[model samples]
Target: MALFFANGATFATWGIHIPTIRERFGLSDAALSLAMFAVAGGAILVMGRLGRQVARLGSARVSMLSGVLFALATGIILLMPSFAALLGLLVLFGIANAGFDVAMNAQAATVEAAHAHPIMSMLHGMFSLGGMAGAALGGWVLSLGVPPEMHVTAVALLTAATALLTRPLLLPDAIPIDNASTTDGQHRRMLLVLGTLAFLGLLGEGAMYDWSTIYMRDIAGAAAASASAGYAVFSGGMALARFGGDAMRKRLGAPRLLTWSAWLAFVGMLLAVALPRPWSALLGFGLMGVGAANMVPVFLVTAARLPGVAPAEAIANVARFAYVGMLLGPVIIGAVSHASNLRAGLGVIAISMGVIALCGARSIRPAPAEY
Candidate 1:
């Protein structure tokens, strides 16, 4: 739990510094995109390797080391002498984050496997809370006239300390499952299906994060400060609903729950775009948040439980797909908006959810919730 919280907070702090980084380096939009690409590309490059390493060396050890590096990366960014060095550091940042993510989640999957009921949802809920808290605290710190460097350094040290302190608590590595009946082909097919759905699911999530506020401002005709409410409401809704997702998953099962979630997101996004009103848009985005709350968790949990596949390996494979979707989702929307209008771009979110609803429902294995 602490690791999850620290990871979220560390990532959130990096997000808080994005605008600052841009200004400090005098980067144009395209250059910034290149920087972002470096980060995403680095993560993708190492995810499979890190996943395998986590399986071999144990999640606890990898997670501890990754967490430390991940936290430090954010603090080190401001100290870089040039934009080129910063870009290189961002690549390392992505690698550390992906390592931490896969390792921690592999640990979570192991812990969840030991229990009779669900816990992954609640753990992810903590991440949402941590992100909200970290962002809010960062805003407050800026308001207080503290140096941005000081604030980031403080968060880095604290998070790194937390990671080190919690190292002893994470469960030991699980032995590899030896289900020879489950062929490599079966695992590949299952991972491919799960990866596709994860890609679609996270694409919507990334769209919401990047485009929701813009939609509120440009399409819904809101004031600049008021437009920030769009993302606030959406993330708030996600955090609140994730605590209940375990029950939802248990009662509805994966297929039905996923379908229901997709439908909710689809409808929510549709209403937001069609209405183009402030209150209505906020409400719709919030609904989409609730709908999207459990997507990655479900996909990852399913991937981890795949017979004869290492949990970390399966998770990394699926997560790589999801990461690509998230990385491109905003660009895709931006392109669509540039070609047409913001309304049409936002509509793509709805279209994405609609596709996920149709395909995600069928992709999930229909096994009982316990699996």
Candidate 2:
């Protein structure tokens, strides 16, 4: 849990410094997009292989090493000699971040197996709490006129220290499954199905994270103060929901939970797109958060438990598609909105959620595990 918190806090440091990095480098919007793409591209590049590496080396070791690298890469960006250097550092940062992500999740799966129950959602909730704290603290420091370099450096050191300090506590990773057998027909098909669900789930989540505020302000005609609340409420709902998601999964099971969650999301987003009122949009986004909260956790838990694949390897495979969806969702929404209107763009969210509900009769079936 502390590792999750450290990860979130370190990521928050990179996030809050985005505008500063832009101004410092004098980058055009196009250049900034390229830089952001570089980060995601590097993460994507590594997901396929990092899983094997984690399996070979153990998640505990990989988590510590990658966490340290991630923090250092994040801290050194402002210290880069040129724009090219910053871009290079960002790519490394992304790679390290992805490694940290897969390894830690692999660790979580190990812990969950030992407990013989569900805890993924609760661990994810800790990450959410950490993000909120980090963002608030970063915002405060920025408001007080702290230098980005200094701020990032301090957070980096703290995160690195935390990783080292907590290194002794992580559960040992699962034994590696034979790679050849995992690619057999059934496992491959299961991977594809899980990947699809992850793609759809994260597409909605990424869309909300990037566009909800704009939707609240532009379509709903909200005041500036109220507009930001759309994101705040959405994030809050997600954080809160994850804390409850374990119990929900225990009680409801994935198929029924997903069906109900999809319907909940469909209704919530429908309310927002149809009404176009500030408070209504806020309520809608909050519900969207609740609906989206458990999908990834359930999918990941299922992936790690797939019969023959190493838990780490399966997670990376699933996350690979998820990252792609998250990367494209905002762009897709933006293009659709450009062709039509913002409402139409957001309507994509509603339709996608509806698709999950409609098609889930077949696609969501998984091994009879307690995930």
Candidate 3:
């Protein structure tokens, strides 16, 4: 979870500095977006293979190495002298992020089994909390006229220290699935359903993270500092709700919790799109965080517990879908934004979440009693 926190902090810090980098490089908006896509493209190419690599290297080693590499790659971007160097650093950052993502999720699944409880949501919650801190701190520091390089350096040091501190908690053991744990054809169908739902959930999340602030500032008439607050509030609400989601899941069950979460997120998106006020938009973002808090974690836990697939295989499959969503979500939103208004683009996200709420329950049935 601390690793998740550090990863979020690093990503958010970089995101806060994107405009600065673009201005420094004299990049057109299209060029900057393409550079972002280059990063995602790198992750898409490597995430699956990296998951298998984690199985061989063990989670602890992969997590530590990826964390260190991520920090180093992000720090290198601070010194980029041209657009080409920045793009290269972004690609490297993507590789580090994809590797770390697989390693950490694999580790979290193992930890959840050991604890015999719902913990993944809380772990991811810490990531959201860290993102909130990073964005807020980055904005605050930038407002004070600090150089982007200094900000990136401070975040890098913090990431390295945190990664070292948490290295011991990630164990080296793999999931020991019994050979008898085979499933019928139904399990394959279920896996497909769950993967699709995960894709949609991640799509909504990625869209919000990548575009919400821009929508607020450019369309909703928010100041730069106030625009950033949308992301901070969204992340903060997500973190807080995820910390408590285990109890909620126990009380509500996965099916109902997911249904309600999707509905809430749908409404939140609608609120943000419909309300023109900046504060209203921030409130909508908060609702979005609360509603999305546990959806992905629940999907992860559910996928791992499917009848036939080993925990590792299930995680890898679902993770592949997640990576696709993370890669495609922003691009799709950007395309829509270019063709129409940003609000119309975000409306598609709202509609997608609504579809997930309506259809996702059928994709993940409860496991049989004897499994």
- TM-score of candidate 1 to 2 decimals: 0.95
Off by over 4 Å in 3: 141-147, 177-189, 214-229, 274-282, 307-312, 334-343, 367-371
Candidate ranking under lDDT, highest first, comes to 1, 2, 3
lDDT by residue for model 2 over 1-371, one digit each (tens)?
88888888888777778898899989999999888888888999888888788877888999999999988897787898788988888889889989988988989989988886689898888888888888999999989999888898899998899878888998777655455235678887888888988888888888887899999999999998778899898889889989998888888877777778888888899999999999889889999988888778888888888777888888898999888888888899999999999999999999988987776535656656464
Q: What is the lDDT of residue 221 in candidate 1?
A: 93
Taking all chains together, the TM-score of candidate 3 against the true structure is 0.86
Regions of candidate 1 where Cα sits further than 4 Å from its true position: 177-183, 366-368
Error of 3 at 201 (Å): 1.4
Please provide the root mean square deviation of candidate 3 (C-alpha atoms, Å).
Answer: 3.4
lDDT winner between candidates 2 and 3: 2
Sort every candidate by TM-score, greatest first. 2, 1, 3
Which consecutive 10 residues in model 3 have the weakest lDDT in total?
172-181
List TM-scores for all candidates, in order: 0.95, 0.96, 0.86
Residue 259 displacement in candidate 2 (angstroms): 1.9
| TM-score, prediction 2 | 0.96
Can you write out model 1's per-residue Cα lDDT over 162-238, one digit (the tens) per residue? 88999988887564634313438877898988998888888888888889989999899999989989999899889
- The total number of steric clashes, by the backbone 3 Å criterion, in model 2 comes to 0
